[model samples]
Target: MSNMNVIVEKLLAIDGALAAAIVDSNSGMILGSGGSGVDLELAAAGNTEVVRAKTKTMKSLGLKDNIEDILITLGKQYHILRPIDKQDGLFIYAVLDKSKANLALARRKVLDAEQALVM
Candidate 1:
């Protein structure tokens, strides 16, 4: 299994990756982060709310499913938030350049990394 640092580094190796972080959904705290371009601290906190809101909505709708990932596409960037399967209250956040990153591959890579991640 990979450690936090290894996960972050591997994520950054993805083409067009700008930033990556492991965040605590419950506390809106960043556990580990790497890369540059965006402010990860702010992204972590804000995305925590995004996750919480989506979860709350899902519950309200009586959906008996877990989120695979949340994708936020912007004009210039793509933000991916994937909840960790083995660890509740934790997630992997990655930002990629829209023009340079392949969304499908990035998602697959994040999923692979998530499986190998050891909290």
Candidate 2:
């Protein structure tokens, strides 16, 4: 696995990347982040709730699987929340420009970053 900066760098290299962060879900704080044009601090905190709520709903439904990632499509952007499998209570959040980004490739890159993240 790679360190947080390396992971964040890889994420930022993706097409149309606006921002990326390694967030601590337990506290809704950003551990490592890069890029700009978005308020990543606010996004980190808000997205923490999104992860928690989805997990809660999944358990309520009794699904025995884990979330690969959460994709929030907006009119102007794409928000990706991928839980890092190697670390508990942590996730990777990325924002991309929808018009210029390849959704399939962006999602793949996020997954790649998730798998490569270390703490």
Backbone-clash count (model 1) = 0
The stretch of ten residues in a row with the least summed lDDT in candidate 1 is 1-10
For candidate 2, give the lDDT. 0.93
Ten-residue segment with the worst summed lDDT in candidate 2? 110-119
Among residues 3 or more apart in sequence or in different chains, the pairs in candidate 1 whose N, CA or C atoms overlap within 3 Å are: none
Q: For each candidate in the order shown, give its overall lDDT on alpha carbons.
A: 0.95, 0.93
Off by over 4 Å in 2: none
Best by TM-score: 1
Q: Write the residue-wise lDDT of candidate 2 on 1-119 in tens digits.
A: 44989989999999999999999999999999999988999999999999999999999999999999999999999999999887989999999999999999999999988887665
| TM-score of candidate 2 relative to the true fold | 0.96
- Candidate 1 local lDDT, residue 48: 100
